[model samples]
Target: MPQLYLGPWFAILMFPWLDFLIHIPTKVLNHVTPNELTLVGTEKHKTESWNWPW
Candidate 1:
């Protein structure tokens, strides 16, 4: 038998890879951008200034 232990902070590190995992298949099958895949069915919002701090 195998057991797995995941800490509370695991998701913080795992989110990017998890997002990649989900996006790759969707991109291959649906030919959509990761942004599009993530924002599907959601209203588009204005780009935030904080995202570009330069």
Candidate 2:
């Protein structure tokens, strides 16, 4: 019974961190997608590219 209660509470506690994790890329993309922008505008650093044939 205690574990069951903790499970939901833990999820609730983690919700903000989860939301932050989800929010970052959307914010990053918000800059990238606009025509006046091109990249993350952070650095000349390297990144991995993902390719999907679909």
Candidate 3:
């Protein structure tokens, strides 16, 4: 049907706008500093450590 076809067509056309919208928040809020990089290891010291607790 045209409605079903239109849905995908609209989504494909709008994907870049949607992606830009999604990227803004992550670009703004997901940056880490040099101090953060240095303190990334060791879960005992940094609560936000990139380690799996086991």
Candidate 4:
């Protein structure tokens, strides 16, 4: 049995939802994400522990 079920119309119907599912988060992140933090790597932020000054 040749199952020619899904067609271009189905794809067209589903594409916006699929695109939104994929693109929404990315767009939200584009708005929500900090540019420096998103693009740059954070090095370890170490604070010096000073002992009692002799």
Candidate 5:
């Protein structure tokens, strides 16, 4: 995963002391929108909407 690689890269450049301990989890857990992660692509709906027509 690109996020996995980016974590280390970012840590080396930004925060070497913390290293993977902080970077890895943040990248894995952070809810970065697909639009920000991709270029010229659309995100697919992964979860069903709860728009109940009551």
Candidate 6:
């Protein structure tokens, strides 16, 4: 039985995907800009869009 049966290898194979799934939230949140109350912040002056250097 030990030689014929195999454990859940799919979970092991899904390690990278699981890691990405866990990391995407942090990545998206890292890039996200919350609402600002002052004159200058991460977003543009007039619009709600984010400001990029490029």
Error of 3 at 50 (Å): 55
Residue lDDT tens for model 1, 4-45: 445645776798889889977777866544354354567778
| Candidate with maximal lDDT | 2
**Clashing pairs for predicted structure model 1, backbone only:** none
Please write out the lDDT profile of model 5 over residues 1-54, one tens digit for every residue. 686787778767777556667887678766565345546558676997799899
So what's the TM-score on candidate 5?
0.23
Model 2 scores a C-alpha lDDT of 0.82
Question: Candidate 2, residue 40: CA error in Å?
Answer: 20
For model 5, what is the alpha-carbon lDDT of residue 11?
Answer: 62
Instruction: Name the weakest run of 10 consecutive residues (lDDT summed) in model 3.
Output: 32-41
Q: Candidates ranked by TM-score, best first?
A: 4, 2, 6, 3, 1, 5
Candidate RMSDs in Å, in order, are: 19.4, 17.7, 14.2, 7.4, 18.3, 13.4
- Write one digit per residue (lDDT tens) for candidate 2, span 1-54: 686778788888899888888988789988886777456666687888999899
lDDT of 6 by residue, 1-54 (tens): 654444556666688788888988787876786555467557646658788999
Clashing pairs in 2: none
lDDT sort, best first: 2, 4, 3, 6, 5, 1
Q: Which candidate ranks first by TM-score, i.e. highest? A: 4
Q: Ten consecutive residues with minimal summed lDDT in candidate 6?
A: 2-11
TM-score of each candidate? 0.30, 0.36, 0.30, 0.42, 0.23, 0.33
Q: Residue 13 error for model 3, in Å?
A: 1.9
Model 4's TM-score against the true structure? 0.42
What is the lDDT of every predicted structure here? 0.67, 0.82, 0.72, 0.79, 0.70, 0.71
Would you give me the overall lDDT of model 3? 0.72
